[model samples]
Target chain A: MSAADAIAVAGVTKVFGSGNGQVAAVDDITVSIRKNEFFTLLGPSGCGKTTLLRLIAGFEFPTSGAIWLDGADVSDTPPFRRPINTVFQNYALFPHMTVEENIGFGLKMLNRPKAEIAERVAAMLKLVRMEALAGRRTNQISGGQQQRVALARALAPAPKVLLLDEPLSALDYKLRKEMQIELKRLQAETGITFIFVTHDQEEALTMSDRIAVMAAGRILQVGSPREVYDAPADRFVAGFIGESNLLPGTVERVSGGLASVTLSVGGRIEAVAPDGFSGGGPATVVLRPEHARLMPAAGAPEGAIAGTLATAVYFGTDTHYHVRLADGSDFTVREQNRPSVEARFHAGDAVAAVVEPRAARLLRERP
Target chain B: MARPFDVRRQRGFTVVAAFCFALLYLPIVVLVTYAFNAGESIANWEGVSLRWFVAAAGNAQVIDASIRSLQIATAAALIATTAATLAALATTRTAPYRGQAATFAALNLPLMVPEIVTAVALLIVFARIKMATGYTGLGYLIAAHTAFCIPFAYLPIRARLDGMDLNLERAAADLYATPVRAFRHVTLPLLWPGILAGFMLAFVISLDDVVITEFVKSGGQETLPTYMLGQLRRVITPEMNAISTAFLALSIVVVTVFFLVSRKRD
Candidate 1:
């Protein structure tokens, strides 16, 4: 483990139940979270993201492997002894405690002096901008206020790391957006390593400095948000991060760091092959909908794949055209809504979907 | 104001409810009224007076029995509530084990069995034990009451624990509370209302229990309810009504206090 790594989870595996009913909740996994980085574990439900967070929080003891915090093996350390705190998904604020009391509880547990606790709690309340509601009980506050209180309480201890388990999932869209910025600001101000867990791709992309995309108790890929979204490691990661048009094909040629793959849809497209490509092996070309452009087939450039528009979906910011390619595979091309009325393509319009070679990624097919 | 339902339908429902209330409360009202009757005969009210109340208060046996009953109920409620709380925590908080269903069934057995059967079974066991050791005291009554009251106490405690979000306890631990501290600070405070409710329910059940107390108590260890039964078997008087009224009042006060306490500041 590096000196700057705040947490290092090495080969951790957690299995639940026994015999035929046994299931691995967290398979053998290793990841080093750096100090003061906004790292995220992103996956759908049952993908073990929450379980990994819980394991780090010391809520669950791993069946094997070690968890290192600040260069010390804290695998067996109880949650209270760890220099970490969690903001629960439901914002589990103590219903009986006022916002101030809730925020001060950790300091009290740490045996801090009453005066220091008060000052710290006041500072936290101010940080979350909840000073006015500090005296209100948890149940008396709104959902957003309660979320702020939860954050304040977890942050008041000034732990080395803060774990958030989809803390913004319960908030409305507007509130979630606001808190996303607020959380980023808080992370910067506190300079605490944050391990945020969320299934929301947008939230992860917006807030995290780096993200680990997990599925089925395994880490599929780990990279910065931009790297993971633009150059995913596998079909799962590619599909999970955002909307993508995966064109299945067999590798036709490889040169330098790029490969030409003969698309199953009767086209040959050049893409960046992350792993060196071999001839005659199945591969998939991942094209983000926004990267593919819809153009009239009559005047289309070379390397443009011909297709007939199947549907036109008008999203306020952009229009998406679902085009059926020659080989019966469908791909969607999104275009920003232009001010000109004549730029729109209708269903059944013959068009060529063109994607730049640099924008497409070639990945090996999963067995 | 206009009625939501037809007048006839409302009247019918009111009549049925009133009839049920009368069925439930009229006998108790009559008994209470006769406790203050000036006449010796409980059936005939000559005028209202506190003569029976005075007699009941002055009776040594009634007083002793009341004190004994209070002691038994308090002891039984404490033991039962503690045991029930532990049982609830184990069954609800822990992961499922092989015999979890059986354990639940065992806890509920006392409630499922007939009271008379339980009383007899306890009597036979106590009789054997007493013959072996010659130890007979209020302990037997307390033990029997505690056994019978566990299920009553367990249900509400379990429900409360189940209704509680486990996340709060996790949050407590994350906030630097140890397991024990988390239980003390988070679990216990949140569970107080259920525990208090369980205690009051157990206390009332033990206080009002007659069959179990009769079978379990040794000589001169009669609880108030068993003592009242003995008194009624021999002679029916306004004093009996007075004792019953006082017992009812005590139970109401306990329940009302519990209600108020649980409802406060939530």
Candidate 2:
């Protein structure tokens, strides 16, 4: 554990049920979330992101692991004793309390002076810009406003770390977008380490300083949004983070975090060997549509892969060319529509797909 | 915007609903109306007066029974509600344990069992306890009523706990509130309507209990319902109707207050 790490989850595993019914909700996972950094646990439903967050919050006990908060082992500490707070997915604000009271509840629990609580609550209201409606009951407020109150309530305690469990999942699209930036601003202003759990890839990419993409109760990769999106760690991360054209290939050799792979269509391509890549086996090359472009097959570059154009889709600002390679695997190439360029090719035209250098990577496949 | 199969719009719906309403309320209406009869007999339609109400109020036996019923109901409602709240929290808050369903079934068994059967069972159990302890004060009735009213109270309290968002308490704990504090601030306030509803149900159940009181009571220990049952065997008078009307009004007031309080909370 590093001194700058706000939370260190070491081999944390949370299992539920017993006997024949036993299942690990959170498999053995080790991660270090930095202090003052907005870290996100991104995954689909039942992927154990929420369970992991709950473990760090002390709401759950890891079956056989230690959780360190600020260099102190707090694995056995109860939630109330931990210096962490959570903004629940449903905002779980006290329905009977006014917004001010809800925000002040933590301070009251901490036995802060009445005046100090009032002052802190007022500041929180102003931080969330809910001062005008501090006296309103939580149920009386709109969903967006309730979200703000939840944020304010969680922030009011000035906890060492704030855990947000898909807090934006309940908001409408426009409000969700707005809160994305709002949440980023709050994280920056507070300068507190925020551990956010979200299933929305776009939301995680937009707000997180670093993100841990999770699947099947394990962290697949932990990096900045750009790293995860640009160079995924495995097949699941590549397929889950964004759209990718997965072409079946075989790894000829691997060295220096790069893999030399021979495509099924009798062409050779270079791919970034993400973590979990095993040597000398069949693999799938992840090529983002934007990383490749289509050209006329006649007199095309020698390194370009040859294919037949299957379909072309217009998407206002870009056009997607779906190409069927000789191996029957489809590759999609996206190009921005420039006014100076002409219509490239229609459906069923022979085309050459050119992949940008160091833009594609093959990952180890589970047979 | 109309529904395709609105039950209220079905053929003969109004007639059927009215018939059911009459079947339920017409007898109560006649009883309340006759409570003001001037004549001694309840069978005849006499001039309207409050003579029976005054007579029932002045009668020492009726007064004693009324006070006894109120005491038992109040004590039982309070004890049952507290126990129900604890049981509700235990059942709903924790992870599902072995025998959880069995515990729920046992808690609600009184609601499923016939009242007379429970009365007889309680009579047998209490008879042994009374003989061994040599105690036959109001404690026996209160304890019996408390036992019978538990399920009446548990159902509403448990239903409320089920409907509540468990995350509210979790959020409290996350906010540094201890478990007890969480219950006080988050769970209890949200559960007020359910608690009040449970208390009312238990109170009403205990207040009018006749079979259990009749089966278990020692000499000179008559509740209002047992006293009324005893009166029915000898003679028929409008005083019974007067007492029933008063009891009905009190119940209506309790229910109305509950409704208003719950509505205002919302």
Calculate the i-RMS of every candidate, to one decimal place. Answer: 0.7, 0.7
- Residues A196-235, candidate 1, lDDT per residue (tens digit)? 9999999999999999999999998899999999989898
Off by over 4 Å in 2: A250-261, A272-284, A339-343, A362-367, B1-3, B6-11
Clashes of 1: 0
TM-score (all chains, Cα) for each model = 0.96, 0.94
Pairs that collide in candidate 2 are none
Q: What is the TM-score of chain B alone in each candidate?
A: 0.94, 0.95
Deviation in Å, model 2, residue A337 alpha carbon:
2.6
lDDT of 1 at B205: 91
Q: What is the lDDT of residue A47 in candidate 2?
A: 96
Q: Write the per-residue lDDT of candidate 2 for residues B1-266, one digit (tens) a residue.
A: 86798899889999999999999999999999999999988879879999999999999999999999999999999999999999998999998899999999999888889989988898899889989999989888888899989999999999999999888888999988898889888889889999999999999999988888998888899999999999999998999999999999999999999999999987
